[model samples]
Target: MALLALSKCYYLGNLDQKVFLNEIKEIIHFHQEHHNLTRLAYQSAWELLIYTLIGEKFYEQVIVIELHFVRETRRELEELSKCVDWKRKKVEREKETKEVIVLMRWLNSLEFFFRFCSFWNEEFVGLFGNVVQLFRASSGNHREIRGECIDFFREAAGNKIMKVEGLLKGGAIDAVLEEISQQSLNEDNKICCFSFFLELSERLQEEKEDEKEEAKRKVFDKMEEEGLDDCIIMFHHFLLEEELPFSYPDENLECYFMPL
Candidate 1:
């Protein structure tokens, strides 16, 4: 299922190299022990695609550093697993994860990391590309959170949900949205995703009159330090004069803030 989702990640979004390598390592190691090389290879390829997408998010220099780490660790972990014939060690490490996923805690570490990345750009976006989604999923115990965000909101907002007879055409998403959107999901995810949407919408609005006034103060202060306040005028201030833009309709998109 992860593999299937990952296969679509490339055209869908990108990830940072460090994040990609770490995530790919978890994915590869999980199924590496499988008896069928074919299945494992398929999963690996999908993970590689995801990694490459993530790699593209970074500059070449940063990616090179992370690639070295990924290669080194991949080799080291492979060697470590081989040197130990003890099934107990493998079981111990895997069991410690608490979840069925490989090195789940390590993956859990990525939550804060992706939130940090989001401050940069939404370009590296995908099903689980945003770490906050992972947090809402495990911490809140919402198994369908991914489905809610991806299957329902993101994809619907993206216009990706097609005419499926029961599942999508007339599905649980329809039901859930009716309830949740009416009064919000009342879950952590509801607060998080909805808050994100609200913030994004507000950001789309260029600085308000008060914000412009506050911004003028800061700019003028900086200009006093640099002696360039009069020399600097707000260029490309169209946002201040125009209405906030909205994401356009598509066959595969959902309106995350439609509740408004």
Candidate 2:
């Protein structure tokens, strides 16, 4: 309840700015010490913290705070997949559902934060890797969060502002592309995977011919080896049928979309 109230203060700018920031840092520190990752209450409070920080326009501060516990936080998120008993009654699953929702909201806030903040350095590479882990863990449950994970990949991979070198170092491309090859994912995730391929294909178009060919070769070779060469055609059809989610679809992908 205090965290929620603090969020309002932070958003409304009702408190002294430095004091509020320090209090936020202290509050998160307290939560980290007191809240076990398995508890829905912990997840809820953590989500509110992220919400408050982003609402207060403290994106860099949030990044710094999260980076401090990135590995632990990621492990907690991945553990969510294991802790839930899906066969339990709906009433029993309520807590798990709420935890997933809170985590998803936290991830959504991170995605929004990254949009306005440039991540060009090695310090920010963990965020990219966390997204990949979250993507893998969000599978089989929490479809909405899984979709949001793919949305992050699409944005990060497609956006020119995002540095390719950093993403590569973080293994975002290989991880996501490997996920695209997996057959067990749900339909929403499949669509998202296809969308990621389309966005990546279009992004590569901006590179010089030789660089683009080398990159495409690497991506296509991986896809082909995985027996998902058809995904290339499927993504192209999505563009042609106007099913892709991009606001502005690239028209030059037909050449690349040709059978490999």
Candidate 3:
């Protein structure tokens, strides 16, 4: 509750910039050292971190090195990832499921923060490699984690903050496309995967005309190698076979649809 209230105050501009940065640094430190925060606490901490970064004050402080938010956050994420044994059996990992989900959420939030803030420095760019590693470590049976991983990829690819080539080279394309190819994914996740491909294509279009064709060829070559075309065909077939809530009228020309 205190974290939520603090986030509210920060959002309202009631908190001093120095104080808020200090608070954020402390929170990041705590998270780095502690891996047993409750789910609600993690949610509140995530909200607080979002509020901290959404404002310009944090960015200004970061630029002048008043705060080590980026470096600290990277360390926190590294420590958090260490707490989860992704290779363990499902039964063994059941106790850590909540932490795993929290980790994914943090990754999504950090990716968004970096993208929105345009933090494209070497320090920030290095984090994308970590995102790919976590995504690769994720179990195929953990749909929620994989879904969030897909979201991180979509956000990373949709924006100009991170180069598409870097992401592709970091194995993001392979990890995401492999997950999308899983036969057990539901329709919603399949749609999310499709959006990632679309965003990737859009990002590629942003390249210079001279280099655009080659970049597209390389990305599409990787996609084809991962069987993305087959996945799209399968998703299309699934959509076609899905039943609609309302049916069309026959040739009798009578209106059969009714509004709720």
Candidate 4:
């Protein structure tokens, strides 16, 4: 299986590449093994985290790379969402379905990476939306990944090349911000969430400045109608005093993440 081969590389790759690949690697990072799977795969829980991100240019390349990831990661997240009563097979099926959600998060990162590359794939945008549907408050990883996706899109709100039109058009931002407020006040990720909302607020300022008055007015009016003031207040309540990490737009994006 492509999974077995990739697992070898994933577990044994040079430190540089291992660190590089870890960012977009899904939590369902590999297929199941018989032994102590989690420990064997990740001795340090923090090691499982995504830190440094790698961006690419072309949609086709993103697709190919992500498909490879799927081939390798296909085994762990299979469960059925359709079953009312927990049938044995249904449990098995939704576990698989969970992988689909994980894959969408991976794709979301790829789409962001491609903001540096020339290739654009509309399917990835659509894929991101599909993954959000599977986000349930019951699942921990799902909740985490969904938050990360929200942060990613919030940053992407002003992206010139590929704004997630569906999200912006459909009001997903408000829905997710509301969800974030309802979540447990887990302190670990609070800083990250605060940073993301700040980024969104910054983008809103930019929209007010760059776009026409009518568009800006409409945006503000929409925010008012949808309880965005309360959401913004919620964001401020969560904000910490620490400095947020600032990442500037890549000016020389034509080459860096572009497919070779």
Best candidate, TM-score-wise? 3
Give a tens-digit lDDT track for model 3, residues 1-260: 67645645544654455666666666655765785555546556655656556536445355324445556555656766787766676666536555676676676666556546654555555566677666766664455565676777777776665677777776778877887778777766666667677667656656654374576467667767898997656655765797644333453422222211
**Worst 10-residue stretch by lDDT in candidate 1?**
158-167
Q: Deviation in angstroms for 64 in model 3?
A: 10
lDDT of 2 by residue, 1-260 (tens): 55444444435644454555565556556767775334444444444455445434355456455535455456555666465443455454535565566566556655654554443336557777777776665555545665687777766766655666677777777777777677676656666666667766656555444574587668767878899968877755654676323344556645434432
Model 4 CA deviation exceeding 4 Å by range:
7-56, 59-125, 137-165, 205-260
Q: Model 1 over residues 1-260: C-alpha lDDT tens digits?
A: 55545544545444444555566555555544553333324433434433454323453223224333234323333332233323234334533321223223223222222332212321222222232333233333333323233233322222211112222332323433433453435455565455444433334343354466687677667767997744455532633566644444543324544444
The residue-level lDDT of candidate 1 at 135 comes to 28
Relative to the true structure, how large is the alpha-carbon lDDT of every model?
Answer: 0.37, 0.58, 0.62, 0.42
TM-score per model over all chains: 0.28, 0.55, 0.60, 0.40
User: What ranges in model 2 sit over 4 Å off?
Assistant: 5-19, 32-62, 65-72, 75-82, 85-95, 158-161, 178-260
Assess the local accuracy of residue 260 in candidate 2 as a C-alpha lDDT between 0 and 100.
Answer: 25
**2 or 4, which is superior by TM-score?**
2
- Best model per lDDT: 3
